[model samples]
Target: MRWFSSPLRDCASPRDPSVSRSRVFIYLGLAVTLLLLSYQLILDRGPGIGTSWTAIQGIIVAGDEDRFVPDYVQPAEKELVLAAMQASNMSWVEEHLSDWQVNIYRADAKHDDVGLTVPVNKGNEAMVYLTYIIDRYWSLPEVSVFLHGGRYQWHVDNPLYDSVISISHLNLDFVQEAGYVNLRCAWSVGCPRELEPARYLRERPDDKGHPTAVEYPDRFMELFPRAEVPEVVGTPCCSQFALSKTKIHEQSLEHYVRLQQWLMDTELDAGISGRILEYSWHMIFGKPAQYCLDQRECYCRTYGYCNMTDSDIQNQWVWRGLQLPEGWPEQSESAE
Candidate 1:
């Protein structure tokens, strides 16, 4: 009767709204802190998204190395001329290489001509013209000695020889088999071994069971040991390396939208096969761009963006199972 309530009842009846609000605020603060910490961690540890993106920014831009040269070139007289130009005055050549008025051309029509023009000061114009003439004559596939060294040498077919040497994406089989060793030796040590054939051929067993095909056997054996020959020798062996499926299929829904956007932005030709798309993405992304991987959510949350495509996504899945390189990866294959 004197308010007859126990301490527990009294406390429950007069709940402190301020205390409840404080608990709510505490929980909210903790959640925000956790989110910020998670974001920071993602930025630090991921598949080099931002770094790759930054690297790729200039890649797709108008003025790029790709725009200048499409493929690799070997060491030859043209390279020596370029080296001379660089050594003599890099700043001057760099400024004048793309001038429409100057019109610099390579000697090797197939390898040296990259179709770049640069403007230069009038005083340096004669030197540039003389250099172009020298390059053209030296680029002749038959030219043997470079003016600078006076050493005998064969012309390398590719103009982007330096880039070829730096490329790390070459096939492992070629690397292990010493496919490029002869070329390296010839370039550096002036070895006299004949250039390895750029093309591959299949050797078939003759009807009499005799060794039938000896075409380029010496060159082939230099690269491949006799014991490791494939059971079916004549069948061409090529590989297409890509990322795993689980990585490709994660976030299928969102990835689908991004793929559509990329397709729209690039204006890629119609009838683009899935395998080609996958290959292109792999080249650009350095991995499979699909969204189905188990840990893709983690990857997406961290990277903020993913390289995915839809038109060829399903096709890639089917074709990937066949374990065959795409019938034609480069446009040149069709030209052939």
Candidate 2:
């Protein structure tokens, strides 16, 4: 009798082994219920298991009108853009979409845009609103075209660029030719024509505290890296940019997940991380030729194309004598 002790025969209820067994089942059932509840919560909060989640090629229209520092605040004129999208019929664009959903954050208080829906007191900013899109969806379109709510100087009806009569028609050709095409603003937007990284990093590294921003000796390295801070940067200088699905497909969804998470969690303002990623988008794609033999072809492959060729190299004008870095293609004989 002593050798065959029951597994659930507690000293307090030795005679009622059945009761103890029943209690064990009760505890087990409670544990299972808690697990199910927790799992449901996860599904509600995130696109959890078996949730046919699809985040693919599409657009993200965001608006945060009143909430930014003066230097970085969004343009106030975005209400006009929203008025246009609502007035026109954009349902046709949905036909080409791989994913059925379109996320819109209206620039004005009058509508329910993503920017308006997101809780303001929480650490959400317009620059990082796109981060919320990636984090919450657990997926991103291969080619994500992000546009600020406001209008820019480059707005065009049509100029012999593409087949469609859309805003994208103005950009698709240029982006196809380059990895990422920012608004070609007045006198070049990113990396001032004269402020080369080589002379600037040692002489004036980014005011310190910017771990992810570094001047790359190899400009090619900035286009993409297995792991490292992006130093080779330039300025599109605003919230408007387009990413190619092919180049973006090179990395896993987890990479974007972590990136968005960091943008949300970090104390550093958009001035740092936002600006870091802003300049880094093209670099994230990849660079081609060390030197452009044919400037036009070299410039054309910069954006939409995945692989750069001998005809590679996006059209970027590097600075003069001051920026002669050690690793990058040496300054041209004439420039030196």
Candidate 3:
């Protein structure tokens, strides 16, 4: 009747101490490796996340004592987002937009250290512009103005084609009211009927083998699958524009991400992909295919060039500030 040790108890011995310790060490190693990878991913995303967080907290990231803000003008809740190439001149932004937050996304891989950098420089300004919207969608300023990196470009709507002048005189009130404003008000380049989708889809040998037009139809469908391809697509040339946060939020972040994904996946060269976006931007921002605003009204509303007549717009007097003709209508308070 002595106590008997069961065979089951004898077989069920504790695991070897070394084996148990080895598993613990293995788990520790895996956890450290995962953490390192996560950190590297955050680094790859660059300063966009950090900047967005700080911006959400109401902090202005860049300001210079040397930059002058006129005493009469109060600080504004606006941001200027630029898409810069390697050789683009950004000095004008520092010199002119002292009161606004400026975010420059460098498209060139060579200039890695300059400004904010896009993940890949595929679709020209389209890549940078879409990236800014997707990144800062959660923490956008009251109004975000997107522009090319150069201070002076032919695409700009200002009389001198100077971004500095256009942005400096930009009517934020109009932007607030309009929701989406094409920075270029002129219709000389792209407007009324810039691209005929049916015509562009036809391949032609004379295009020097560049098949951008031939490729645009498929690309357009990729971007807006649910919508029909319009016969004509038009908007002011280049991608410089502004959007109030309210307008930006009208389309969900997923909408922008899908557009960015199309940019990444498209095989069209940077120039052509960018050109397609150059026309599609207005539609993306809820404007009609023929997004040609009245030239006089656009200048008066978007840039405070009030009372500009068709002749003045034709002569580019909006930017020149020539003497107003007698009995010109008073400047609308809304324009101011």
Say which candidate scores most in TM-score: 3
Tell me the tens digit of each residue's lDDT in model 1 across 177-201: 2211111211121112111222223
Candidate models: Cα lDDT each: 0.28, 0.39, 0.75
Which sections of candidate 3 miss by over 4 Å? 1-76, 109-114, 199-210, 317-336
- Top candidate, metric lDDT: 3
lDDT of 3 at 136: 73
- RMSD of model 1 against the true structure: 24.9
lDDT by residue for model 3 over 1-336, one digit each (tens)?
Answer: 849878887779776899899999999999999999999999887776654443445332122222121112122489988888767768878887888888888787443374566666898889988877776766678899998777655455654556788888899988989898988877876777777776665542345564565666778888888888888877777788899999999999778877877787777889899988988888898888888898888888887888977677876624323223232224432454
Give the TM-scores of the predictions, in the order they appear: 0.21, 0.41, 0.68
Tell me the deviation in Å of residue 321 in model 1. 54
Q: Give me the runs in candidate 1 sitting further than 4 Å from their true place.
A: 1-13, 44-216, 224-336
lDDT for 124 in candidate 2 is 23
